[model samples]
Target: MTKPTLIFLILFSLNFASISALSQKPKALVLPIRQDVGTNLLVADIYGRTPLKPVGFVVDLTTRHLWVNCETNYKSSTLTQPKCKSAQCQKAGTKYCHTCPIAARPFCHANTCGYYLENPVTHQNTVGELAEDVIAFSSTNGFNPGPLVQIRDFLFTCSPSALVELKLPKGVQGVAGLAHAPIAVQNVLASKLGLKPIFTMCIPSGNSNGVIFFGSDGPYSLLPGLDFSKTLKYTPLTISPFDEYYINVKGIKINQKPVPGLNISLLSVKDTGSGGGTTINTLLPYTILEGSIFKAITSFFAQQLSKVPTVKPIAPFGLCYESKYFSSTLLGPGVPSIDLELEGKDAVWSIFGLNSMVEAHPGVLCLAFVNGGNEYRAKVNIGVYQIKDVPLKFDLSKSVLGFGGPLSGARTHCENFNFTTVA
Candidate 1:
């Protein structure tokens, strides 16, 4: 072949290979589960402040099926709150007795015990059989049962490695990072033991905004390490994919002027107490507006900022706003009040006005206003401020099946996993 033709053919082949690699990248599948509504029964049974064996089961409320795997099926027992026959019971002339004297077994008295009968086809000794039963029960109930995402298959090949990458939705502002240690561990346990996935948010130190990542298990690195105690604390809001969690801050103003527009920017400032300072430290650019509350910004900021070192210290820092608009002088000089409005996802917006005068040194102030005989306010402090309040919208147009599937081997220790971004 001619040299020129050969060179052109080689370049075309390389381009084809690059395109193929990009097309085969793994994508995230986030399934939201309502921990409050659907998992009520499970929570009552598991976290009822009573110590019990960690028995896992799937309840498909949609199908009205209750699948359980206990060491013994005592549902037919005539005794209410049945207990093992003790020596005391024997001395009392009864082989066994109910713990409560007034306790009664209505099902036993009614003789309608068909539901409590054991299945003769398979003894409940095997884990696989128990899982099947649980799945069946879940299907019988109205609670929607998600498709069977094989634990081994899903985690094994969900990504090229065990580590997964997450990005904040556009319009949300905050630093990005790993979820807190306890939250991360809880999610991992839920996926491994409860066979469920969870979502969580984290913040970086000194920053007021953050982000959320949805998936089955928490990142391994997010678990308790040598410095677990130092990690930020996270509050689990809702347990479903449909519900969004947020934080709200009140009483903020811009140079004594109420922030006017629906979109507001959170900027990180250095030396907040100074009368007029311009040296600004910009962290993560912008975050989506989930709600019109400062607490929501705080929640998201704490989660995502935990990952990036440059933005880590900002998590714990307080937010400050200029009480007067274009007043140049701090609020202590009696400047006019300014109001700011921030918008998150779902068209939700929060308003905070700077009403209080700033102290000589850096500190926080609240912008106050009265409505219907009730006063409302937003928080504005003098410190570092990060941009927050945008829509919670993400781009999923370009996505591929995430790692961990049939092609991948069984789940391995997280130490064996590694993640690298494809630029």
Candidate 2:
């Protein structure tokens, strides 16, 4: 080869190698969440807090900031309290500077930003110093995890252990806030990495790990290379002033028939923000509906399944029946499907038997729903149990919710996601 030809070949080889490396870099951050059956809480694996310790955090959808227990021998070289006037403090919406009456420690620092962190499980509030630390997550190509990506100064509150003493699941140290707040881990990661503010969650119903992806839609590639994104149905997502997610659900249906006596006006939000509406909540285990809505739904459901022998009602469950009477389908129990009539043409979120009914006891199946009482603000509160096994994408940038309705329609489930580490 001539000198010029050899030089051209060398440059081409270098460029090709660089492109190959870039292509292999993960396009999204992935977090594996395990379902704690006893507590009905979804716990996510997080590696952080100086020296990088692996900790489990309950996934809280309504929490504004990530709060962790730092009162017990918490030591991190990268932990630093933000000044009251710092940008970090402003982002957290706290203005008061904290004062420590006792000795200053990690969360009890003086002249630092004071933030009120809530225990998602107990709903108890405590004041803690707003601080930053190094948090890391595994990067993924939307299929398998690649390597660890670090966020050098992730913002969180160093809370006391009292908030979690008896409330949270065992081995879980903190709450990972995935709400629509600016300081939420998902948004911070997206902003820092220059990616779109979007996230997708597929909660597993079984013992296996579920998957959550930040910044990409899919090639979700559960076993058999199925992409749940293809089945997604789009609907406008409304974020309340309180940072809760609400959908434009106009009505409800059972077995393709609309429930009678459902006050259409009761399904809407009022001007005072205290009237009836539907909102999604991960903290809640079962779907809760207003008293009237609940009565109408259960009455109609029981009527539809008249062939099944009724049994004495369970304490929490209003209706119960012999489980043997019901047949099994790939979707779930062979029961009537419930549909949420949303805004737009043909936008209905169908909830199959798996998402609608729960086996409260052996040989006994009950509707996995609760009456929110007449005073409940939201007419419909969609909980995590009803959302599991469905691929849900929250596009904060576009204010849209893309729901890949029940995967059973495609003969797959959320637990099918491969968790094996990629080399």
Candidate 3:
């Protein structure tokens, strides 16, 4: 054989080996029987908590199934009849072979019926028919067999012990015990999407009287980009330096009264040394107007003790305000309002300002305003300024401080004085 031909053959063999290895690697397994069991049956007792009330009992007739015997108590009974036998053998006086009625059977007192006879050759056929007949009879007699509600399965419950048993279809191997079955099923369903489990709870079934508990799972991280669907309703206003950006947002409704004092502090994702961001307590005395949007701009001043040829790299941060309207009403003619509040920390301002400076070199300013917290107006004018440029001691009357809004608007005024210094 030629040298080149031999080399090609060796390479081909190596490629085939690699492909075989790749095919042998295990993939995520998704089990077929993944459904909310909580909704299927009423969970009277959880594993760790108090014992559950008995829902029902199980009757197993499987031959040689000793496991069933260990879990249940068995009882048996017999029937007997008595005959009037006096002088019948002597003179036939009041002698009779008394007939006993069916109701007189002793077995009836023990809650049992006639014993079932089994044969070796007919074992499979007989047991199969017996199971069907038992189920049918139980159903007709108002006894819940608790058989498999779905295919290839069977269920039995021990109400007294709060025990439940599940029988998988034949040939399906290695079924987990009842305690861990739900978790196993959950892992299978989540494998395909690479999702993590979160809170799990039982949701009440609409049709059945029972509750179905499904594990609610999601990705650990929020999607990187801003969620636009959550943003479209509220307008993103401009931010300024030194002026703490205060946002008061409310919802609007037709022919409803205006709501007031629905205010929230804008927060920044970045971390500042002082726990970065404004909180509701710090912004006290400022009332959030109902149905109106409040945006307060503040001034920003940068002071450098030493002037250098190179520009100092400063971290810029600003606030991102989000409002969720819980309820709203119509105020006056065509006026609307809502109830809302803020969430998160105080250092958010610094982080937001730093990021803002890094991304866009917008001038820093501080703004304030006064308006009713309950009304939403058509339009308003907000003030903005830089802290360094403003006079160290300026008269309130001379400065452009308070905000202007329509009379029909809520949130008429704002008050909160706190600041943080970061080097």
Best by lDDT: 2
Worst 10 residues of 2 by lDDT: 1-10
Candidate 1 at 274: error in angstroms? Answer: 42
User: Higher lDDT: candidate 1 or 2?
Assistant: 2
Q: RMSD in angstroms, all models?
A: 22.6, 8.4, 30.6
* Predicted candidate 1 versus true structure: per-residue lDDT over 1-423, tens digit per residue: 223223323433333334323332112222111111221211111100011112222211111112232223212111222122433222212332223224532222221112211211121221111111111001001111111221221110000110111221121111111122211222333343443333322222111112222342333121122111122222112111211122222323443434333223322122223211111111112221213334434333323334322222222223333323223332123333233222222211222221222222343332221111111111222111121111111111111111111100122211111111111
TM-score of every prediction relative to native? 0.19, 0.91, 0.15
Q: What are the per-residue Cα lDDT tens digits for candidate 3 across 140-183? A: 00111111111111111111111222332212111121111112
lDDT of 2 by residue, 1-423 (tens): 223223323333333333224434357877777678779988876778667676778998788878888888678898998987999998888998988877665468778998888887777887877889988766667766555667778988888888878668887888999898988878888877766788899988877777888887666777767887777888888777778778878888999899988877777655316657788888888998889888999999998998888898876778899889888988889999999998766679999999988888888999999988875567889899899888889989988888877777777777776555352
Q: List where candidate 2 sits over 4 angstroms from the true fold.
A: 1-26, 103-106
Give the Cα-based TM-score of candidate 2 against the true structure: 0.91
Ranking by lDDT: 2, 1, 3
Candidate 1 at residue 385, lDDT? Answer: 16
